[model samples]
Target chain A: MDINGPVESTVIEERPGRRRLPPQERRQQIIDGAVAFFAEVGFDGKTRDLAKRLGVTQSLLFNYFATKDELIEAVYEQVYLNRLAPDWPDRLTDRSTPLRDRLLAFYTEYSTLIFQYEWMRIFMSSGLSGAELNRRYLKHLGDVILRPLLGEIEFAARSGGTPTMEDIWNLHGGIVYIGIRQHIYRTPCPDDPSVAITRAVDRFLLAFGVEQG
Target chain B: MDINGPVESTVIEERPGRRRLPPQERRQQIIDGAVAFFAEVGFDGKTRDLAKRLGVTQSLLFNYFATKDELIEAVYEQVYLNRLAPDWPDRLTDRSTPLRDRLLAFYTEYSTLIFQYEWMRIFMSSGLSGAELNRRYLKHLGDVILRPLLGEIEFAARSGGTPTMEDIWNLHGGIVYIGIRQHIYRTPCPDDPSVAITRAVDRFLLAFGVEQG
Candidate 1:
C-alpha cells in the first residue's frame, strides 16, 4: 500500500513549457481537453496526463484551476449551460402549442446535445455517489438550467393531448436512457433504435393524452 | 507499454503447501468471491485484489482459473444462471395472455433485477465493445425465454401493435443501456425510477395490446 510514488501535484498541476492564452481561451482549452479526456477514459484519467496533452506543466494547470475535481465541476457547469440556452427555452412559453409536442421537441434537442457531447457518461457516472451528489447535480440542472425549460414547458397549453412537465421528464428520461443503452453500450437490440424510440415516445405521448403522431 | 511486469505462470501446476478441495466446492468458492467483488468494485476490480480479499496469492487464486478475465466471465455466467431461475421465461409463451401484459411483467422483473443486483452494471458495461458480448447477453433472453411469458401478453393478437423481433431487440438494447446508465452512471431522472419503470411498462403493454390493468 505504501509503494512510494511521484507527487500528485504533478498529477493535478500543469506541467511546464505550455503557451499561455488569454483567460477565456485558456479556460475553453481546458474545458475541451477535459471533455475529450472524460469521454474517452473516465474520471480516473490523470490531470497530469491532461496537462501533458496540452504541452503545459502541472503547475500552470493549477494556476488556472486549483485542483482536478474543481476542474470537473467547471466542465460540468459549462456543458449544463450550453444545454440550457436562453432563447429556445424562453420561446417555449407558447401556451398555444401542445405540451407533448413541445416536450418531444425538447427531448429531441436535449438528447441530441447529450449524444453530440458524448461526455455525459462521465458526468452522470460521477453523480451516483449518494443523495448529496444527486441533489447537487439536480440543483444545478433544475435551478439554473431545467427550471426555465420547465417553466416554458409549463407555460404551454395542455390540450386534450398535452403531457404534463412531470410526464415529460419521466418519459424523456426513460427513453433517453434507453437510447444510451443501445447506442452507447451497443447492447443487442431486436428493433432499430429509431423504431424503438418512436414507440417509446408514442407510449409517453399516449400517457400525456396525445395519440401517436 | 513495452515494459515487462511479473511473469505469471500459465500452467495449473501443483505448488508447495497447496491444499486440495472438491471441484464443486472450489468452483462455488471462486464464484462467490467473484460475485461479491464484482458487486462492490465492478469488473475493473483486479483479480489480484480479489486474491488479497480471499487471502490467497495470485498463483493460488489463478490455480482455479487460467486468467482474471475468464474468472470474471465465469462469475457473471454463474450469477446470471443462478439468479434468473425458472418461472421467468414461462410467461413469454403463455399464448393465452396478451403480449403487452407479458412484456410489462418482463420489464418489471428486468428493472427489479438490475436494481437488486449490484454486479449487473459490470455485466452490461462490458457488452459495449462487441456484438459477441451483446449476443451472449441476448441469447439467454431469447424467444425461448419469452415465448411462455409473451403468451399471456396478447402481443401476437395485436397485429398493428406488436413490434417485430428485430424491433424488440432494438428496444431491449436501448432500455437495457438506460437501466445501466441508471445503475452505473446515475443519470438524473425527473421522476422516481421505480415509478418510471412502471409507467414505461404500462406503455409497453399498451403497445403490446394488453388491456391496462
Candidate 2:
C-alpha cells in the first residue's frame, strides 16, 4: 500500500508560493480555507493537504490549531455558529414591529445565510460525519432561534394558547425546505427569499389562524 | 511506509467464511449490501470492506459489479429509481379520488418510501457526493412525480392559469422537509407522516383557495 509518493506533491504544485502574515490573519486564512476544503472533502480530509492548500508546512498549520478536531470545531463555529449575528433573536422577537414583517425579514436573512454552497456542504458533511454536529446545532436552533420566533408568533397571534413545537416546525420547516430544494437539490426556486418567506408566512398565518396584514 | 498488509486483512478477519452463490443472486446481494453500506459510510467506503460484510471474496464482489462506480449506480437505481411504483403517477392524478385525499395518500406513501434510514442516508450521501445525484434524482422527481400532481391540483382547483413549478415546489418541498428534519436531523416529529402530510396539504389547499372537506 506504500507508493512512497511525495508529501502531497499535487497540493504543493498547485500553489508554489507561500505568504507570510500576522498570526491573526494566518488563523483566519486557515479557518477560511478549512471551511471550503472541509465542505468539499468533509471531515475525513487530510490536514496535510489543508496545510498544503494554505501554502504552509503541516507543522506550521498545527501551530495555529492544535489538531484536526480543533480545526473542524473552528469550522463549525466560523461557518454555522458565528454566522448568526447577536441581533438576530432580538430582531425576530421585536414586538414593536409588525409580526409579518419581522417573520419575513428574519427568515429572509436566515435563509440567505444558510443557503450558501459552503454552509450547505458543511452542513451535509457534518450530518454525514456521525458526530452529531447537526444535532447540537439543531438544539441551539431550538433554544436560541426558533423558540423566540415561536414566542413572538404566539404573542402576535393572540390565540390565547401556546403553539406546539410541531406547529412552529411546520412553519419554519417550510422555509427551510425552500433552501433544501434550492441549495441541496439545485432546484431553481422561482421566488427569491423575500417572496418565498412571504408565501410561507402567509400560509403559516392562514393555517394557524394568525392574523396579519 | 510499506507495512505489507494482506489484501483487506482486517475485513477478511471479520468474516473468515465466504459463501458461493449464483451470479444473479450474488449480484443482487452485493447491490443490497452496497446500498446499506454506502448509506452508512457513503461512496467513500471500500469495496473490500463491503465484500467482507457480505461474506464474499473481494474479487467475487468485483465480478458481480465491475467497479465501485457501477456499484453506486446500482445503489441509486435500487434505492431511488426503482422504488417509485408505476401506479404512483396515475394515483396522483386520479380524479376519481378526491384531490385532497390523493395528495395526502400520495405523499404519505412517498414519505414512507423515502424517510427510512437507508433512503434518507443514501439521499444525503448522494447530495454530498458532488456527483449531482440529488440533482439527477430531483429532475426525475420533478418530471415523473411532482409535475403531474400539480396538474391534478390545478385541474381540481379549476384555477384558470397553470401553476408554475415554483408553486408546486413550495407545497411539495414542505412535505419533503418534514422528512429531512425527522429522518436526517433526528428530530422527533410529534405527528406521524400522515398527520404532517395532511397539515401541509391543508395549507396548500388554503393557499390556492381550493375547497376541502
Candidate 3:
C-alpha cells in the first residue's frame, strides 16, 4: 500500500550496471520511468528523485528532457496519447458494422489499454493535482470518439428521437467507471470486463431504439 | 492553478482574533478545515501546516484529535459517511413507487451530495494515496444502495433475466461519472445532472425488461 514504492511489476527496472542504451531507447526508458514515478507520486515529485530511481545522473536525465515540465509533457504523450488507437474512430464509425458490435469491440479494446495501475493511477493523480493531461485527453476523446459515436447512435436509432452527446458520454463514462472501480478504488472487477461492456452497450442501444440481434 | 492555494471560497477561514470556541464547535471547525486542506494538498500535507492554516497551535489541534489518523477518520465521517442519507436504503426499496422513479430520485439526491470540489477531489486523492477511505466507502455504497437496487430490478422485471450486482454498478457508476467528469476531469458537465441520471436509470430499467412509465 506504499504509494511511493514500486508497486507495479510492469515498470521497467533500472539496469544493474551502466550498460549503454541508444539515445532513442534511453529517452523512451526515461519517459517510461517518469510515467511510473509520477503515477506513484504526484507531479510535485522532484526530477532528481526520478533520476535516482532510474539510475541515471541528474544531468543525463536533463540531457533527455531539459526541465520537469518537458519531462511531464513526454509522460503525458507516453501514457495518454500513445495509448489511443488510431483506427478506433474509423472502426466506431464504420457503417458496415452493427452499432452494438462496434461498441462492444471498441470498449473491449479500450478497457485493455486503460485498465492498468500505471494508467489509472497517473490519470487520477493528474486530475487531483489539476494537471491539463486529463482535460486534454477527455477533449480529444470527445472530439474523436464520443461525438462520432453519438452520430452513429443517431443514424442507428429506430425511433424515440435523436440521441445527444451527453447520452454517448453516459455510455462512455459507465464503461470507464468499471476501470475506475478496479484500478482507482482497487475493488474486485470481473477478470474479463467484456460481459459488463456488452451489457452496457446493449442497454445504450436499447435506450436509443436500436434493435438488438 | 495553484493546488496549495485557497481555491475554494467555501473553506472556512481562520478568524483574526483569538476567540475561543466551544469544544464541540472547535472540533467541527477543525474537521471542516482538515477536509478542505486534505482535498487541496492530499493526506501527506503536514499537520503543522494545517494548524497554521486553522490559526491554532499544533497542540490545540491535537487536543481535539490525538493523531493525524484520528483527524482523517473525522474527515472520512464528515466528508463521506455523514453525507449518506439514512433513509436512502429504505426509500430505494420502497416498491410503492416505480423502480425508475426511485433510481432517478436516489441518484439526483446522491449527486448533489457528492458532486462538489471537496467531495470529489478528496475521494480521488484518498484513492491515489492508497488510503482505506475510498475502499471502505465503496463497500458501504454497494451494501446500502446497489444491492437493494438490484433486488428491486429483479422484482420489477417484466420478463428478462434478473439483474446482477454488476448491472446495478453500471447504473450507479454511470451516474457517478457525471460528477467525476465535472469535478475530476474539470469538464463542462450539464448544469443539472438529472436529465443524464434519468436517462441512465431508464436505460437500466429497460435492459432489465421493466417497462418505463
Candidate with more favorable, higher DockQ: 1 or 2: 2
Looking at every candidate separately, what fraction of the true A–B Cα contacts under 8 Å does it contain?
A: 0.24, 0.48, 0.73
Question: What interface root-mean-square deviation (Å) does model 2 yield?
Answer: 1.8
Indicate the docking level reached by candidate 2. acceptable
**What is the full ranking by TM-score, best candidate first?**
3, 2, 1
Residue B113 shift from truth in candidate 3, angstroms:
1.4
TM-score of 2: 0.84
Lowest summed lDDT across 10 adjacent residues in model 1 chain B is found at B146-155
Best of the two (1, 2) by lDDT: 2
Clashes of 2: 0
User: Is model 1 an incorrect, acceptable, medium or high docking prediction?
Assistant: incorrect
Q: All models: lDDT?
A: 0.57, 0.76, 0.85
Runs of candidate 2 exceeding 4 Å displacement? A1-18, A57-59, A158-163, B1-16, B158-163
Better model by TM-score: candidate 1 vs candidate 3: 3
Tell me the tens digit of each residue's lDDT in model 2 across A80-171. Answer: 76766788888888888887888888887888888787898788777776658688888888888789887876776654345566667767
Residue A86, candidate 2: C-alpha displacement in angstroms: 3.2
| lDDT per residue as tens, model 2, B142-186 | 888889877876776643244556667777767777777776777
Residue A104 of candidate 2: its Cα lDDT?
80
Chain A TM-scores, candidates in order: 0.64, 0.78, 0.83
